[model samples]
Target: MAYTTLGDTGLDVSRLCLGCMNFGSERSWMMNDRDASVDLIHEALDLGINFLDTANVYSTGESEEIVGDAVASANRDELVLATKVFGEMRDGPNGSGLSRKHILDQVEASLDRLGTDYIDLYQIHRWDDDTPIEETLAALDHLVETGRVRYIGASTMTAYQFTKALYTSDIEDYSRFACMQPEYSAVARHEEANLLEVCEAEGVGVIPWSPLAGGFLTGKYERDGDPTDGTRGAASESVRGYFIEENWDVLDEIRALAEAKGATPAQVALAWLLHREVVDAPIIGPRSSEHLRENVGAVSVDLSDEEAARIEAPKTPRWPAAGKD
Candidate 1:
């Protein structure tokens, strides 16, 4: 459980953040019951994981409720709790997006659901094209000023949008984005183009989601054969996009490296991210204790420079038009 300050902020968080997207009711395909979720939370805390990331849209807020109850017994001051706003939480035009109404309403709802007074990091799930960036930044600045949210972050936005938001915050003296939650993994390196570069240059911490590429990097799926039964990739449509030839090549490299290093493919995949200078933490959503333990082991799975380079040899150009010279 290596710890580091989140981006330029002094808030310390674990290298592996426990993602709570899989801790709700049966409504979610990978969800666990209340008792099971609580047990998992306890295991994570016992394993020295202080950072927990969740979103309001996960299980329609049931995940937050479960997380709130699960972490009730833990020392609150030592925990770094994060949740997201966006994704239609209800009906009507103001139900979602980064509008003032949506952010303000959702923050309170999230706080209530989490059983906490302040969120360590409150992130916008994605860019809201409908609302002006200024409006969203102002509302987020208010949350920091009012002490509802300690720090702010954004997820899955283009580098231009992220840069614009940061500039807006700088000129307006609002709370700047302290972190970025992008979709990055051994098989999905699209963010390597400009989003990661901007964050690295701007000192914004990168806490990537789906660091396993929706279980594609876990070595459970086969290139020429069927996916293992009951795996997320087997039943979910989300994994279909990553089931390409190029990613399979990347997975082969990862599998070979894992075998050579005596680590699981998941650990090797996570270790690859942990080895990156730009990434602060890779969020892991483990559905069981075994999965949790395996993910946590990634913290110690050190990768040599050669092994790291080999794992990423199959990366395609993130922005093909902006070809590298």
Candidate 2:
């Protein structure tokens, strides 16, 4: 596994973060086996993956528990453990959002579940329009000051919201977000419009989620046929959004390039993210050992500038290319 610092921070993390969302039984497509999840995490750790990203809401903290169990025998100091807040972890009052009360309450719960006192990186799962950004940032700053969280980050949100949070942190002396977790892949280039440019300008590290476009770029789903049974695309309506003709064209390009390089389409797709200068790591959530190994293999698959461009040409970029009106 390749290692790099998280954004501009000195905290070293694997180029591919092990996403723990699939470890729980919350969804039909999830692994749903605690032992199996633990084993998968162990396999990833053995393969040199030091970064693990999970959230309190994933299977109601079951994923974190599984991660905690898997990392128990490993060297703790070498791992970069991350988790998220701003998700509904319970019912009724104080159940979610980035409010100070929820954040304070959730951090302890996350630490207890993860069996760790300090989170290497704690992120807000989404923008909390309900709570003031100042309140949220102050709470996260408290986490950093108290040593409960080493660094703070944000997930999918508008460029304006992210910029506001960053600016608020600068003025308030709060813990600034060190990185961002955006939905970015060869098939999903929407962030390139403004969010990515802001991240680039602000020197924030980007660890993109769903780097394979929910398995669309892997060519697992047939263009003319429905998703195979038991697949995430089969179970998730959001995944079905990638079935349009345009994404199929993107997959065609990826498939051709993969054949030429003697690599799986998934590897070629992930390698495209690895090739981006803004991407510090692309979080890979593999349910099985085979999938984990295949995704990890992407680290070694090099792509030339022309090949990368070919993979991108099928989809029109949300942001206009430089020198183009």
* lDDT scores of the candidates, listed in order: 0.90, 0.91
How many residue pairs in model 2 have overlapping backbones? 0
How far residue 21's Cα lies from its native spot in candidate 2, in Å, is 0.3
lDDT for model 1: 0.90
- Please write out the lDDT profile of model 2 over residues 1-325, one tens digit for every residue: 8899988899999999999999999988899899999999999999999999999999999998999999989898999999999899889999999999999999999999999889999999999989999999999999999999999999998888999999999999888999999989888888889689999899899999999878877788898898889887988887888777777888899899899989999999999999999999999989889999999999999999999998888777564322110
The residue-level lDDT of candidate 2 at 240 comes to: 88
Candidate 1 lDDT, tens digit per residue, 1-325? 8999999999999999999999887444666578988899999999999999999999899989988998888999999999999899888889889999999999999999999999999999999989999999999999999999999999998889999999999999999999999888887787888689999999999999999988888888887887766777778777867877778888898889889889999999999999999999999999889999999999999999999999888776474222110
Q: What TM-score does prediction 2 earn?
A: 0.97
The positional error of residue 180 in candidate 1, measured at the CA in angstroms, is 0.3
Best by TM-score: 2
**Model 1 lDDT at residue 268:** 95
The alpha-carbon lDDT assigned to residue 187 of candidate 2 equals 82
Scored against the true structure, residue 98 in model 1 reaches a CA lDDT of 91
List the candidate 1 regions with Cα displacement exceeding 4 Å: 26-28, 320-325
